[model samples]
Target: MKSSRIQSFAAGVLIANSAPHLATAVTGRQHLTPLAGRGSGPKVNAVWAALNLVGGTLLLRASRRGGTERWDGDLIAFETGCLAFASWMAGSERWLRTNTARQE
Candidate 1:
């Protein structure tokens, strides 16, 4: 049960995380990534996005092994993870902006 919840949460986090990168890739925008670091190109972003999507899909499948029996709980956990990631991203952006402003 715990494993399933964890997997669902991770899947949600990864899936949500991939959306921006994929959008950047499609729009030909450069984005920083852990893999390639600063100024990563669209091609690299595309690949990174795909990897995240695949990983998330796999985790989702693993978590869904329980079928529809306990899907409500799984969905809640997944949404919570997504929300957590969103909060982190927002906070990171604010932190970066503040630090950048301070440095100038």
Candidate 2:
């Protein structure tokens, strides 16, 4: 019983931490800017977004494999950070695309 409880708690924590990453992934897919008229800004943002996506995917896989027994706070924090960054990048890309489209 105790072990199960602990497992549940760890899973909960992991899920909570990973939620932002999942959200970011969705946002990234939805808000990707076009390749055209990217200028310098979109290129930079794309790099960041790609990094974030990669990081998030890696962390998610780690979390799944690690499970409750191997849960690490640092990993969770890193994942959360990556997710937040990804979301910001996605938003930026979307904005740039919209503005560029309007100008053209």
CA lDDT, every model vs. true structure: 0.83, 0.46
Inter-residue clash pairs, candidate 2: none
**What are the models' TM-scores?**
0.86, 0.30
Return the lDDT, model 1, position 67: 73
lDDT of 1 by residue, 28-103 (tens): 8777778887778799899988998999999989998757766877898889888988788879877775212245
The count of backbone overlaps in candidate 2 is 0
Q: Highest TM-score: which candidate?
A: 1
Which window of 10 residues has the lowest lDDT sum in candidate 2? 29-38
**Candidate 1: stretches off by over 4 Å:** 98-104
Give lDDT tens digits, candidate 2, residues 1-104. Answer: 33433333444444443444344344443223233333324344455446545554554554455356564664545445545555665686577653334554
Model 1 C-alpha RMSD vs. true structure (Å) is 2.8
Tell me the spans in candidate 2 whose CA falls farther than 4 Å from its real position.
Answer: 1-40, 66-104
TM-score of 2: 0.30
